[model samples]
Target chain A: MDVIAGLGQGFLVALDPINLLYCFIGVFIGTLVGVLPGIGPVSAMSLLLPVTLSGTPESGIIMMAGIYYGSMYGGSTTAVLVNIPGEAASVVTCIDGHEMAKRGRAGPALGIAALGSFVAGTFSIVALMLVAPALSRVAVAFGPPEYFSLMVLGLSILSFLTQGSMAKALLMAAVGVVIGLIGLDQINAMPRLTFDRLELVDGIGLIPVVMGLFGVAEILTNIEQQIRRDIVQSRIGSLWPSKEDLKASAGPVARGTVLGFLLGILPGGGAVISSFASYAIEKKLSRTPERFGKGAIEGVAGPESANNAAAGGAFIPLMTLGIPPNVVMALLLGAFVIHGLQPGPLMMSQNPQIFWGIVASMYVGNIMLLVLNMPLIGMWVQVLKAPYKILFPLILMFCIVGVFASGNAVFDVFVMIGTGVLGYLMRKFGYEAAPLVLAFVLGPMLENNLRKSLILSEGTFDIFVVRPISLVCLLIAAALLIAPLLPALRKKREKVALDATD
Target chain B: MMLRRAEFWGGLFWLAIGAFVAWQGWLLELGTLREPGSGFVFFWLGLIIVAFATSIAIGGLRGEGPLLGDLWRGARWRNVLLVVLALIAFGFMFERLGFVICSLALLLFLMTVVDPVRPTISIPVSLIAAVGVWYVLEKMLLVQLPKGTWVEDFIPF
Candidate 1:
């Protein structure tokens, strides 16, 4: 009932030898993929999803969660050493981190990043412990209408912020919803898009789609370009930050933790936006703004802390409200559903061990990451030297085996291949897969809620606008939809004015 | 001329898909607003898709987009095609040829044909990886990977 008691029980679960082993494996693999350029946590998690099926739910979830945050720690390594960001969250780290590496301060830069990540990660877990229960209490009051509105707002924000054309992104979301409609109708139990195939009745398998889209598509994209990386040749100096360096970085790290935690609660692009925002804030606050691009410790400290904190904060919505704020959370949501556990307000009350065990594991995982990364930095660098040609075939094997073993259906394999090709084309055309995946996951819930709300209102279209929370969500969705168009409309009006003057 | 652009073609493809879904939803009978039917959401989603695709098509009509050919500009089509074919063949023969033989062949082809490592290296590596993965999945994880219909009859392992 109390936070302390819950955490005490959680530590008991997390400390169990099996869960600890899985956590270590997760973070270790996370760091490996995070150091390597092409593969990411999403692919790693998806590949391991089936394997975790054999383990207890606590161990399975602990492993997956470890991969999510562990990658955040490992991403900085490549950014500091090779100037290639292992993940999108690490992009900002490349700016000052690589510069520090060039200046022979790579060790301190990396040391500060790990230290900052540990502090922010632990801070976020404490924050999560404090905040999640309260939020779930509030979320318990929500009805179907509120859920419908929330999903609408979530999808709109996701599509609006996705890189490239908003129209294209929205179109992809629509496509995803359509694809999700393939299974037997939830209400009547009649197949909608099965086309007489029995497998379609169960719907398109999520594992196959994810593995195909993120895993296979990535490999296809990477092989298009020649694989080459230039490792930083200079000696990595001492792995400790000096007193002056720590003092200089403390302020940025604190600010980044607060900013990242707040931003990570939002629906779309939170981690990325927070990292960039933290960098901008630090640069603005700096007396020596000119020093930012040239090996400034603050640059490395702020964004690294922000991204790690953001990863932790992103778990809140999924845990409390049953809404995933990002793609990684979406996969975790799938994992929860696979384990026959529904994550919502009731989850905290019903499954305290699972809820708190994962929370406690973050504490263990963060400490493990610090220990793993600091002494084993050279080993991670050695992992980066593994050739892409050799690595890819192994990755491909994992994808195939993972999918086949999970479902025991060859049809799923075909689905993966088809989606993989579609994913590849989508990437080449500049359409992002995040919105699509998120929309697909949310589609069934959205439709079910919409129908329920309509039935409650007795066919009146006024139900959505009549409810205050629903009205606010719809209004926000409308704003996000129109927000992207304003800039384009303004540009057209400006062009018209210039033409008239000419 | 607009159709020469990748965006235009993509938009058209989505438009066709939208139209088809809308037609299917209609046939499923779009229920009244009071108690929505299964088709009600699909119908509206289809319409929304159509609207978005139409707008994309209009933008593409300006003919200021990358050509369709640009999609494969730097791709090694030969390698890509080989990998796809290998996967399809593997999936096709998974149960018939068994996990070990099919996976080994797939790896050998990828290493030797698509990317072209020497046989001396590709042979042992493929054998180890294929057998190693089978042991892990089937034996350790207790997943039921296919044991090959024909090959199992002979080897009986």
Candidate 2:
């Protein structure tokens, strides 16, 4: 009854003319970024974090959330038409989607992707609505030790899942935490790594770091290589899938949605992993597995659905526990903080309007994306035609402007440049930045909880072990951290990484 | 051989950083575990970083990674160098020359020197983007941007 009533109230907030406008803007820009390479939701969200300040908190958050899921939908367009994944999650789509395009089935390939994404997106939102409330209730009972242990588990899982050496991932996470802790100490108000600089007193701004690492670094990486686009030149005939095509898609869509939602809830799992896993599962399950890379409709249906569902599912931890599971969600957390709102256990009870409004607005945004993607495919193809040479310069300019506007200081701009170069170097050395960014966001909260638990326990480490939740979390983290040491487990991890790369 | 490996140099860079962080933490004073001080987490994290970095360096020492030159073997590295230098120049001149001038100069340089887009597309696009963004941020959003410390008197808005 409470859920229904809250949803009823949420629709009222979401249907507001102004909020509807913001939702449209969000999804529109989201699709644009998703269609373009060298820019993803992380860069887009950080770039617009300051713009969110102009409106009411609900409106801003509604827009930001739209960009994330909308990107999942737009990404497949580029993958299917151009054979280039616009964003990471769409990489699997390029395998069969472009193949279908080459085989003169571009219309049906696109049609199924859109339909599958819509189904999965709607399903995940419904699940998020149901699951987030129950999860928040459980999260309310969590203590400092529990929070600390959970964060450790999150970091450990991320390190374990990252490609290449686990040591590099762990080191990056550690470096992130140290950078995060550079400002004045939260407990005693004593400066640790400030080096007597006033800007350091506030610590590094998330916008600069994110923009530098993601936005600027992306440009640097892309410019170092020649990027080619091979758009399927054949005219797309009809977008509506044939009855047989729809029949083949239904099962994959259903399976992908369920699998994606579950994976999306995991700390280290998201749309990218969900999509890849779904593709592998579909290929394995098919009796005629030989058709997977040869333009199978199931290939187009499954991963597209899974990634969209995962985008929705990734919201669970952030909305309910105030812990962002991925880099994109971390940026969302930054948005919430900038708005003077905290999204956690108390959010549903205290700020029901905001919570429900965001939920309701997603339903509207999903529909908007469907309309935008279907008949307007030509517009996106035109956008794809814009040369990288022209785009990179404009993107670089935006990076500078966005960073400078974020903090209204030149120091922040320099920070973006420095990190941009560092990020470029890290990429060359095969270091993944996801763990580092996630750890940076979690560092302060993790430190605070650890200190609080210690104070509560009178310096005894028993506080962590005695608590059941903390103990379980710590045990899981320990297992993950140790799993890479075993030869068999190490091989499996490498195989998963290789599959992802492939 | 180890010195030519990319991971070896990367690990060594982080190892030095980890040591420096640990030294800084010690200087800041590590409080008791019960009453943890500001540097307590930092000190422990620094040691963890050092340990992890050592393993990575060892992996490199055993020749388990790509050679440093291989990272940029076939790439257009000159474009990257130009972009980086251009960004640094923009940063130095941003406040003194103002947002519009700096942006226009940076965009034009990128399109021209780095990749060489035609003048017809580059000139108008740079002008519109620089002026249009300034209008939106300054006039519509009311966010203040640098209006040239030196050229504020000379430029007419």
Candidate 3:
């Protein structure tokens, strides 16, 4: 009942002319970024982040969120139409989506993906409106012990779920944590990794690390592979899904929404894992599992829904706790701070308008995205015609301007270049950049919570066990960390995956 | 032989980096707390990297695979060289020529050097992009850009 009222208030906020404008702009830019292969929302947002420093946090945060969710909506276009994934989340969509393209059903594959996404996105937002406040009530009571436990879970889940040997993932995760420790010590106001340079006082900036890893690393890898060979245009026939296609997708969308929402609330690998999980589940439930990698519409429907739901779900932890669940959310946190608003449980109590306003903005953004994306997808297809050579320099310049303007410092521009080089090296060596980006974003928070938790517990480590929420979170983390190790669990999981994919 | 060549070179590089970092670490005051000095982390990470490089060298020497023949497949060294040189030039030109000219030059060089293309099409496109972008960023959006001597008269009010 209360959720309805909150949503009404959100609508009031979102309907405001300025907020609406920002939402539209966010979706427009997001769609543009999402259509281009080798570039994603992270780079787009980072390039624009510094430019938004003048706006109220509400407008800024809403705009960025619009971009994030909007990109999710647009990410599948290239995957289905062009056989290239614009983002990692869209990779699974490519398996069946591209196959569907080759079968001359690209239009239906795309249409169903968009429709499933809209349904899932809207459902999840509604769920967010209802579940967020209740969760916030619980989160408001969290202590440092709980926060620390949550972070540990975050690190462990991120380390374990990534494909490849757990040892390598753990090694990368460790490197990320250590790199994150580079700035300053959260406790006692002492610096741990700064070596005399005055700019080192604030440690390394976030935009640089993120842009370097996801953006520059991508450029390096893509350049190394010369993959721009012309692909034959798949016949893009009807824009509407067939009756059977709709029937097949309906159940997957529903299941994906529920599953994605649940996973999104967790600490790490929320959206990425949810998409993978949804694809796996859809294949398992299908009577024609063999149809999956060979142009199955259900494959695209499930994961697309799941990923959107996961995006919506991510807002829960961020709003409920001051802690951000991922790098994107962390950047949102920075925006919130800039806007003179602090997001946490008390956020609702202090500024209902801003809280409900942002919530309402999501509703507005999702609708704008669906409307904008469906009709203009043809225009988006044209975007693929632009060559990477022409685009690369523009990207580099955007990075420079963005980093420099963030604090109005040239120093950060240097940071962007330095991180770009490091990121390039990492890609060459087969080290993943995402964990490092996540670590850079989460490092300070982890440190702050650990030190604060220790202080709150009066140096007694047992406090982490006393709290039920923290204990449960820790247990989840332990399970995730150990899951890859247990031979039974490993075999079962793989069998489950292979069987589902069969 | 390719992995060996890479690894031998990598080992030498890491060895150099590690020694340099360790030497630098000694100069930084440790502050006596043993909580790990600012330099300590880098020193140790570098040493570990060097050790890993050594192992890679040994593995490569064992010739686990045809490293030489397999080296350049899908490898695009030209792209790296283009980007690296362009960036160094861009970095230096940033303060001197300002963002507009530097970015334009970078865009031009990148299109020409990184990915080979027909210059007849690329040149005019690059110029228009450079000038068009300059107008949008500086004239329309009101971002202050570096004023180059030649473009002082071209600066849009």
Each model's TM-score for chain A is 0.95, 0.99, 0.94
**lDDT tens string, model 1, A332-410?**
9888998999998898999999999999999999999999999999998888877777778888888888888768899
**lDDT of all predictions, in order shown?**
0.86, 0.92, 0.74
Question: TM-score of the B chain in model 1?
Answer: 0.94
lDDT: the better of candidates 2 and 3:
2
What share of the reference contacts is kept in model 3?
A: 0.20
What order do candidates take by DockQ, descending? Answer: 2, 1, 3
Candidate 1 segments exceeding 4 Å error: A488-502, B118-120
DockQ of each: 0.72, 0.89, 0.26
Question: Which candidate leads the pack in lDDT?
Answer: 2
Residue B138 local lDDT, model 2: 95
Tell me the docking grade of candidate 2: high
Candidate achieving the largest DockQ: 2
Better candidate number, 1 or 2, judged by DockQ: 2
Q: Number of the top candidate by TM-score?
A: 2
RMSD in angstroms between candidate 3 and the native structure over all alpha carbons = 4.1
Relative to the real complex, the DockQ score for model 3 comes to 0.26
Chain B TM-score for all candidates, comma-separated: 0.94, 0.98, 0.64
Worst 10 residues of 2 chain B by lDDT: B33-42
